[model samples]
Target: MKRWCALTKKKTVLLYLDRGGGAVGVCGGLFTATQKGQKAPETAEGAEARFTRWLQSEQLFSIILSSMSDLQEALAHRGSSPPSVISAARSGLSRLLDHLLDQSAGSFSGGASEWLKLGLSGRALDLKALVSALQQHFLLFSQRLHSAEVERRSLRLEVTNLRRGLQQGVPSDHFLSVCEELHQALSREQEAQTLIQDQSKQVRTLSHSTQELSQARKEVARKERSLRILGKHLSGVQKEKQQLEERLQRAEEGQRDLSRRHECVVNCLKSAETSCKQLCHACISRIGWLEQEVSAHRSHVTALRSELQDACLRDNQAFVPVEEFPEPFPPADPETPKPVPLS
Candidate 1:
């Protein structure tokens, strides 16, 4: 017995040493391994602890071994250990198997003290050997029972066929139904076998496929890296588009504002133009009235001048022409086309 290499479902090789100075292992979930030709450091405390653990584990493993050779091989690794201890371990294994399997515990002599001797005819009756013998017997019985059932079914088919050939033939519906069921079962089995063959074919090609898997992984990783880079580029492009869209929206708002201002300015100009037209009409009317007043005053001055000229003639004074007098303002025709004053 040696320190456990692993307490797992798979075999694990370790650089530990055992008494046999070689290797021994168990199958299906628990096994041990050690470094070849290597030995543990001799220390009292370490040896006691290792022995205790091994003692506990070995007794359990001995009960688990289905093969006599595996059991013998395991026992051989004990290598010059105390017989009393080995006997105690074997007895424990026997008792445990008896209890677990519900076998008669007293069938084998526990006090024989010769568990190390291998083979069925040996002085020590190994309990594992008895279990193996029982399993063989059970398998043989099952095979015989299966052959008997096949023969029985074959005879039933023949009887059914022969009855159907007779004049009074009336084939049993139950038998025919069973035969149909058997045919269906056979077809299903063939399909299952086909599926198994396909799986086996895949298994045969597994090494080549496994080799390709590494390259496939590399390709996948490279594709992932490229995808990541592309994603980053896409994100950047989207951000730029968003920024451009925002700027466009802002420009649209500014244009709307400008249009509103333009509309307001146009409305104001229209109102100002209408007011200017009204003021110009008023000023033209006032200028026309002033022109009429000036015309009347001119007429009065003309009459006075004529009268003065006659008086001057009577008194021997020189007459002056009305044209010689300077006009008080420019003529109305010129003033009529002049610009009006703004309010």
Candidate 2:
């Protein structure tokens, strides 16, 4: 009797099992409970907890399979309601299978094959295993999709930052051109300063030389004045020497006349002394007077000789040495006189 009851429980459990693409509706109440509870919750964590609860409830199919294995023991103690109970069990099993198949069919779309390639396939040997596998696949797929979206957003933000940096950087060629212009300007400034310094040095040297030239001109002017004074004095001395030379020549001529007269008187006295021995005394007195005049002229001639000698000595001392002039008078004669030449 236990064996018969066991065989009937097995048949009831088999009625709820999912064939490929089939419906099962016994677990529909649990999905309804989750949907109603999710209406007030807004956060991802709350939604995840609800989904976990739903998966756990779906695992109750395994417990139902175990209960069916003990149905034989339960049927043995029953009185007379076996047929009615078996009918109710069969109806409940049918409803459960119908609900599961309906839910699976609702999840499928025209692109169901593509979804399966992306690891969304839902195939299992039993209802419990199928629910567990589907739950795990859904959780992992949702997590991977969210992570991929976050990574794409981060990459876009980094690209924007790099573009801004490029806009702010300076151009290399323009900076180099500015540096070259500054260097050229500095070089020109240095050259101008050097030229100014050289000009200043040359001006100083020329000023010093000009000062020395002015001093030399003053000395030359002073020497010219001294020479003019000396020239005037020399002219005066020359005129005086000329006059003295004239006077000396005249005196020399007078002395020659006197000597000539004395000689004539001596010749006449010699001729008279012989011829007038017993002659008159008057003749003798006239001869004596002639001798007196001759003596006086001799004294005058001696004085004039001394004056000429003195003038010659002064000329030697005062005049510049030069060739002497020739004497201007002849020798004295007793009876004749010669004229003297003036200088």
Candidate 3:
């Protein structure tokens, strides 16, 4: 039997020829009918693209139908006001196209083919009737879209004229008055800002002065503390001076006592010298008597020797200076010559 292949809008459908000379059921379950033997391999990406295209076509058909219904309703309510309805329909179409594009970019893994197969199962669907309805609605939608473009242009022209009127409509006097008021308000605001800046500067200056005062106060406190320390040192120095004065007074008293002792020793030496001179004179007189009588001198010499010993002991024992002795000794008289002391 001769086998042939046919492609359709939905998918690839496999048709087999039966031995009974009749067409059998389709394989692969695609919308496109083709011979079953030695089928070409369908790539995953190609299948996904086909599915996406089919979905977008169906969505376009639905959008056309919806737009037609809206147009019919709008025409019934407001006889010739088709611009609003047409714009609404255009917006809906745009959204539908966006949705279809999104679905085309989404995941199309292993199970997408199964979903396509299920979608192709008709269950009493009339594709021809759907195509006819889509054609009629699409024509109506196109005509309305053109009319809407014309109306949009007219609306843009009216808006431009209204803008021009607003720009050049007011009196020059009113505009000048508004400008003058704005200038006055701006001048007042600038003055207020200048005053605020001046006040802030004054506050900062005052704060700096306060800091300087605090530093001066601290210096004063430090000086006062130094003065207190100096006072304490001065008191200590005064006490040291008093102690030195007392030591000086005691040293002066000791010097005076040493002077009195020295004077006593000097006077004792002078009195002993006078006594020795007297003894020497007595010895010389005795020597002359002894020469005159040699036998008689022996007894006299013994008595004279005993008297000299007693005189010498008495002079040695004396420790006091003469109270009657003058400070400046009297000179010896020429009539009564003083005796020279023995060596």
What is the Cα-based lDDT of residue 141 in candidate 1? 46
lDDT, candidate 3, 58-176, per-residue tens = 66677656646655566577555667677656655554543443343243223245444445444323578446534644554564566567657977987998899898787889889
Task: Please provide, for model 1 over 109-169, each residue's C-alpha lDDT reduced to its tens digit, 9 standing for 90 to 100.
Answer: 3312223322233333368854664564455446546655765787698688778777464
Decide which is better by TM-score, 1 or 2: 1
Cα lDDT tens digits, model 2, 231-302, are: 888788787878777777778777787778877787778667766653545456655665666667666676
lDDT of candidate 3 at residue 302, scale 0 to 100: 55
Worst 10-residue stretch by lDDT in candidate 2?
Answer: 25-34
lDDT of each: 0.58, 0.55, 0.59
| Ranking, lDDT, top scorer first | 3, 1, 2
User: Candidate 2 or 3, higher TM-score?
Assistant: 3
Ranking by TM-score: 3, 1, 2
lDDT of 1 at 327: 40
Flag the better candidate by lDDT, 1 or 2. Answer: 1
TM-score of each: 0.32, 0.23, 0.34
